[model samples]
Each structure stands twice: as C-alpha cells, then as structure tokens.
Target: MAEEDTARHRARMQRKKAVIEERIARASLERGVFLLHTGSGKGKSSAAFGVLARALGHGMNAVVVQFVKSRSDTGEEAFFRRHPAVRWYVMGEGFTWETQDPARDAAAARAAWETARAALTDPGVALVILDELTYAFKYHWLDLEEALAVFRARPFHQHLIVTGRAAPAALVEAADTVTEMGLVKHAFQAGVKAMPGIEW
Candidate 1:
C-alpha cells in the first residue's frame, strides 16, 4: 500500500476508536435487559438459544419455554437440557394449522405462560428465553396487558429474550433491545429442503 493510503486508514481507525470508546464510557447501567427478536426471517429462536448458551458458559441459570414448537427433539434442547442449570419446556401441541383447535391452542399457551411465570418470578434464574411467544399475542391467545404486567414484575436482574414473528407493538416498546431479522433470500424458497441439524 502507498504511504498516503496507509496514513489515511490509520487516521480513520483512530477516529472510529475514539467514538466507540466515548459511547462505551457513557453506558454505565448495570442490570439485565429485555431483548426481543422478531421478523419474517428465521434464526430468532436460534439466536436466543445461542444467548442462553453464552449465559450458561458464564455459569448463569436459564429457563426456556417453547410456545409454538411441540417438538422436544431439537439439537438445542438435546444439548442444553443436559445442563443442570437449564430448565427446558416444550409446551405446544403443534402449529395452529396442524392442531386445528383454537381452544386447545389457547389453553396450551396459558399453561406455557404459567410455567414461564414460575421462571420469571424465581430470582435464581439469570436468563429466560420465551421462544415463539409472539404468536400467542398475534393470535389473541394471550393478553398484552397481562403479559406486560408480568414482564414488568420479573426479577430486575433477570434477562428476558422473547422471539417470534409479528411481535406486538406494545411488547416492542417495552423491550430494552429489539432485533428484526429480515428475509433476503431463503433456500427453502428455492426448493432447498430444511435439513436436519440446520433447521432444528
């Protein structure tokens, strides 16, 4: 590289580092955060599970509640369930279309919420992942006010991760951090089947 180019790059990096350091220094709060991941794209729940793994590595206890997923055989569940500090629950009968029963789905959502309530109230749990929970609000199976109340009342140091598509506006407003995954191009749309170990 030319001398001028090298000097310019070094100056740009120095400026960037200054800005980053200033921002980091301003962020002084020390407490758990509520993160919501929602969108039409995939990997919302997967990302939450990844965070759970990170928390587990730090020796933090966690609870996972899978709302719209009935399968208990996923790779994440298989691996995380082995940990003594992790409490995993698969609390769905199946997808709505497969179940074909609104009443049953509502009941299942309520039951799952109850289990999640226990986790949220427990001070020992450091992280709680409510996987696919947005569907309950989208389908009107769970009330927004009730959920907001419970979320507000959860242990202050407990980090919460709620993942699913079509997240309600109120929940989005309540979250400390929100991520919306955008679908650019999916292999499934191009006749590529979802393979094991990748999709699960």
Candidate 2:
C-alpha cells in the first residue's frame, strides 16, 4: 500500500511539473511588472521592500519614494540606505492625523511625485517603490489619470510598486499584479505597541 501511494504521488508530481513547464514556456514576453499592494493589513510596504531587496541582490538600481511616512529611522530605510544602488526619499511630513493639514500633505506628495517621476523615466532605475502613494489620490493631492499616464510611459523594463490602504479601483485595474492583504488580526489591536524593526 505504501508503494502504491508513492507511485500515485510520483505521477501527480510529474503532472504538476509538466503543467508548470508548459505555462513557463508560454510566457515568452519578459518585461517589468506593476504591483499594487493594498487593503487594511500590514506588510504592504514591507513586501515592496522585500522585492527591492531581491532586486538589489541582482545588482539592479532602484528608487524608493515614501509618501505618507515621514520617519527616517525605519529599519528598512537604514539597511537599504547602505546599498549603493538604492536612492531613497522620505517625502512626507507624516500621516494625515499627525500633520492635520491637507495643504501640507498635498505639497509633500507632489514633491515626492516629482522625485518618482524622474525615476520612472530613467532607464537605469530597474525598480521604483512608491510607498503609501495611494494616499495622494485618496486625499485629492494628485490626479490619478496623470499618474497612470506616467506609469504607462515608464521605461519598458522598469518595475513599479505602490503600497497603501484603500487603493483606487483604477489603479488596481491597471496593475499587472494586485495583492489585497485582508486583515485577520494585528498585534496593535491587542494592545501591543508598534515594535521597532518588526512593526516599523
């Protein structure tokens, strides 16, 4: 009976391999992708940073523009800053609640977009992380269509990542891959304060 089970598993593995190989073969075009990480869960920005780390391992150049995050003391920023290939910009004054000034937030976002726009047009930049960029559109700081046009016109092999809560529907429709992280539970809800390195 063990041998029979082993034979069945082998057959199933072979079938799966064949299917995967066929899909790989069919995907002939190679270009950079636009990824949207949205929803209420944590890790959206963390996931983008993880991808940036993976790309940096390949010796690729990248630019990171932080929109609603004004902190310069985050762990990822500190580590990635050491990498020569990364150009990081913290362009926010803080979260809306902290700033309490829409005009100030808009100005900050516009400045960040200017930095991001330059990177988007640069062929040398292989990856661009626009962290918390969705807030620009959410708060009417930037026009979505204008931003979409820039995304469409970006370098052919440039990968772009946008992370924030409540991503716009238009942005989701345009992204090559969209991952909405649903909140199951969070430590903060259980009275645990945001921890350094882990939560930051």
Best by lDDT: 2
Q: Write down the RMSD of all candidates, one decimal each.
A: 0.9, 0.9
**Clash number for each model:** 0, 0
Whole-model alpha-carbon lDDT for candidate 2: 0.96
- Write down the lDDT of every candidate, Cα atoms only: 0.95, 0.96
TM-score of each: 0.97, 0.97
Tens-digit per-residue lDDT, 57-145, candidate 2: 99899999999999999999999999999999999999899999999999999999999999999999999999999999999999999
Model 1 TM-score, all chains together: 0.97
Candidate 2 residue pairs in backbone clash:
none
Candidate 1: segments with Cα more than 4 A from true spot: none
